[model samples]
Target chain A: MNNIEIKDLSKKYAGFLLDKISFNVPSGAIVGLIGENGAGKTTTIKSILNIINSEGTVKILGKDSKAHEKEIKKDLGVVLDDSFLSAYLTPKHINSVMKDFYQTWDENKYNDLLKQFGLPTDKLVKDFSSGMKMKLKIATAISHNPKILILDEPTSGLDPVVRSEILDIFRKYIEEDETRSILLSTHITTDLEHISDYIVFIDKGKIVLNVPTLELLEEYGVAKCTKEEFSKINEKDYVSYKKGKYQYEVLINDKNSFKKKYGITSIDKPSIDDIMLFYIKGER
Target chain B: MIKGLLKKDLYNLASYKTSLIIIVIFCGMAIIGTDAIYWGSVVIGIIVGMISLSTFSYDEMAKSNRYILTLPVTRKEIVLEKYILAIGATILGSLLGFVLTLLIGNIMNYVRPDNVIDINIDTLLATTIGGLFGVSLIQAIQIPSIFKWGAEKGRIQMFIVLFVLALIGSGVGFLIKESGLSVDIAKLESVLKNFGLFLLILLSFIIYFISYKISYKIYKNKEE
Candidate 1:
C-alpha cells in the first residue's frame, strides 16, 4: 500500500510553476525526491502537506489529503530544513507542547532521543548548532511514532558525521516498524543512495525520472565513445548525452541492451548525481 | 491542538517574564504615591495586551505557520487559537491591572495617611474596562492586518489603518461641531455612567469576534 499518492499535483508562483507531478511513496519504503535548488522539490512536499493551495489530488494513507488533512496529519511526521515550531523553545518546552498535540506522544522516547543526540534540554533551539537543531527536529518528528515521515532537505548543510548519524536514525526508525514510510527531498544525492529505496528526479518543475534506486544505479550507465562512434548510436536508446573534448558521454537506461545492440562495451556505472547532471545539463 | 499551540506561544512569551515583572513593578511604584494612580491599570493593561500579539512575531521568526499546518489542526483551529490567546491575554492583563492598582493604592494610603488617594472602585472598574476596549480595538484592527500581511509588514499596515481611523474620527467630530449639533452633555454622561463598563466589555467581545472572522477568512486560503 502506498502511504502517499500525489497525482498531477501542480502549483503556480509568480515566476515559477510546479508542473503536473505524480509519484507515490509505498509502505515500508524510503522515497527520496532529488532535484536541484528551486527545482520544485520543496513545492511538491508543501503540496503534499497542504501547506500551499495547489491543483490536483493528494491521497495520504487512502484518505483524500484535503478532505482528511487533520486526520492524515495525525499520522504524519514533518521536518522542514528552515522551519520548526520555534527557535526560542527548549527541548523540554517542545516535549511539553507536543504531548498536547499527539495523544500518542511518547515523552520517554523523546527524552531518550534527546539524550542520545546529546541535545541539552534547557538550551534554546536557536543556540544549538545546525546539526543539533536538525537532530532535535528529527527526534521531535519521530517521537510520536508517526506512520509516515516527510522531510524537506533534512540533511542539507550538515557535516558528514551528523548526516550519517541522522541517516542511521532514519534507518532505525523504519526498522522498528515495517509499516512506516519516509519521503524525504534532498539535493544531496549521496545520502539518498544510502537510504532511499526509490528516487524521484525532478528538473525545472517537471518530473524527469522516477524509478527504483537499484534499477537506477545498477541498470543506468554512461557510455563514452568517439564522436564518429557516437553518431552510430541511435538517440532512442539513450536518455541524454554530454559532449566532452575527447568523447561523448551518453546516458543509457540499460548497459547490457546497449552493448548487445551497439557491440560497444565502455559503459560506466552512473551515480544518482551523474544521472541527475546528465538529465539537467546534457543534450537530448 | 489549540492547547499545544497556546503552550508553544506561552513558552515563547515566557522569555519576557522578567521584563514584564519589572515593567509592572515600575508602573505600580511610579503611580502608587500619585493622585492619578488609576492610570497604572491602563498602562499595565495596555502593555500586557500589546505584548500578547508578539506571539505572531515569534511564529514568523520561526516560520512555524507552515510547520503548524502539518500538525493535526485545521486552519480554523490555528486562527481560533490565536484569538483565544489574544483575548485571554487582554482579559488577564486588565484584571491584573485592576488588582495591582487597588493593592498599590491601599498600600499607599496606609503609608501616607495625610495624603490618601481616593481609589474609587467604580472609576477603577470603568478605567480597566475602558482600557480593555481600547486595546481590543487596536487588536481587532491589528490581528486581521497581521493575517493578511505578515507579522512585520502587518504591524506597519496596522499603523496605517489606525491613522486612517483616527482621521475618520476627527473628521466626524469636526462635521458634528460644524453642523451645530445640540449638546445633551448631562444626559449622555448619565447614560455613560450607568452602562459604560458593560458597553465597553460587550463591544470588546463583538470587535474580537469580527476580527476573528476576518483573520480566519484571510488565513483559510493563505499559503503558509
Candidate 2:
C-alpha cells in the first residue's frame, strides 16, 4: 500500500513552476527524490506537507493532505534541509517542547539517540556542527515513531562517515518496521542507490524519471562508440547522448537489447549520477 | 500543540533572563532619587511587553516557521499563540512594574526619612494601565505588520506606521489649538481622572482583539 499518493501536484512562483508532478511512496519502501538545486525537490515536499498552498492533491496515509492536514501530520515525521525548531533550544528543551506536540513522543528514545549520536543534551543547537544538528533533527523526527519520515537533504553537508552512519540509521529504521516508509529528497544520488527502493528524478520543476532503483541501476547503461558507429544507432533505442571529440556516449535504457541489436558488448554500467547527468546535460 | 509552541517561545525568551534582570536592576537604580519615579513602572512595563514580540525574531533566526507549519498545529493556532504570549507578557509586566515601583518607593522612603516620596496607589495603577494600553496598541499594530513582512522588514514597516500615527496625532492637536476649540479643562480632567483607567483597559483589549483578527487574516493565506 502507498503511504503517500501525489497526483498532478503543481505550484507556481515568480519565475518558476512545479509542473504536474506525480509520485507515490509505498509502504516499507524508501522513495528517493533526486534533483539539482531549485529543481522543485523542496517545493514538492513542502506541498505534500501542506506547508505551501498548491494545486492538485496529496493523500498521506489515505487522507487528503490539505483537507486533513493536522490529522495526517500526526503520522508524518518531517526534516527540512534549512529549517527546524529554534536554534536556541537544546536537545533537552526540544524534547520537552516536542512531547506536547506528539502524544507518542519517546523521550527515552530521543535521549538514547542523542547519546548514540554523541550530541550534547544541554548545548544549544546553534553551537552544534552541521552533522550534529542533522543527527538531532533525525532523532527528534523519529522519536514519535512516525509511520512515514519525509526528509529533505538529511545528509547534505555531512562527511562520508557521518553520511554512511545516517544511511545506516535509515536502513535500521526500515528494518525495524515493515509498515514504515521514507520519502527522502537529496541530490546525493549514491546514497539513494543503497537505501532507496525507488528513484524519482526531478529536473527544472518536472519529474524527468521515476522507476524502481533495481531497474534503473541494472538495465540502464552507457554505450561508447566511434563517430561512424554512432550514426547507425537508432535514437529511439537510447534516452540521450553526449558527443565526444572522437566518439559518442549514449545512454541506453535496455543495454541487453542494444547489445544484441548493434553487436556491441561494451556497454558500461552507469551510476545514478551518470544517468542524471545524461538526462540533464546530454543532447536529446 | 499551542503549549508546544509556547514552550518553544518561552525557552527562546529564557535566554533573555540575564538581560532582563540587568535592565530591571539598572532601571530601578536610575529612578532612586528622581521625582519622575512613575516612569520606572511604565518603562519596565513597555520593555517586558515588547520583549514578547521578539519570538518572531527567534523564529526567523532559525527559519522555523516552515518547520512549524509541518507540525500538527493549524495556522490559526500559530497566530493565536503569539497574541497569547504578547498579552500574557503585557499583563505580567504591568503587575511586575506596579509591584516593583511600590516596593522600591517604600524601600527608598524608609532609607531616607526626610525626602519621603509619596507613593499613591491610585496613580501607580493608572500609570501601569496606561502603559499597558500603549504597549497593547503598539503590539496590536506591530504583530500584523510582522506577519505581513518578516521580522526584520516588518519592524521597519511598523516604525513607519507608528511615525505616521504620531504625525496624525500631532496634526489633530495642532488643529484643536489653532481652531481655539471651546475646551473645558477642568471637566475633561475630572472625566479622565475618574474613568480614564477603565477606558484605557477596555481600549487595550479591543485593540488586541482587532489586531489578532487582522494578523490571522494576513497569516491565513501566507505561504510560509
Candidate 1 chain B lowest-lDDT run of ten: B29-38
Would you give the TM-score of chain B in model 2? 0.94
Question: In DockQ, how does model 2 score against the reference complex?
Answer: 0.87
Question: B113-199, model 2: which lDDT tens digit per residue?
Answer: 999998889888988898999999999999999999988999999999999999999999999999999889999899888899988
Candidate 2 stretches with Cα past 4 Å from truth are B170-188
Where in model 1 is the C-alpha error above 4 Å? B176-183
For residues B1-224, what per-residue lDDT tens digits would candidate 1 score against the true structure? 99999999999999999999999989988896478988888888899999999999999999999999999999999999989988889889999999999998998889999999988998898888899999999999999999999999999999999999999999999999999997899998998888877888888999999999999999999998
Q: Estimate each model's TM-score.
A: 0.98, 0.97
Report the C-alpha displacement of residue B4, candidate 1, in angstroms: 0.6
Clashes of 2: 0
- Candidates, DockQ: 0.91, 0.87
Instruction: For candidate 2, write residues A49-159 as lDDT tens digits.
Output: 878899999999999988898998999899998999999999999999999999999999999999999999999999999999999999999999999999999999999
What fraction of the correct interface contacts does each predicted structure contain?
0.89, 0.86
Among all candidates shown, the one with the greatest DockQ? 1
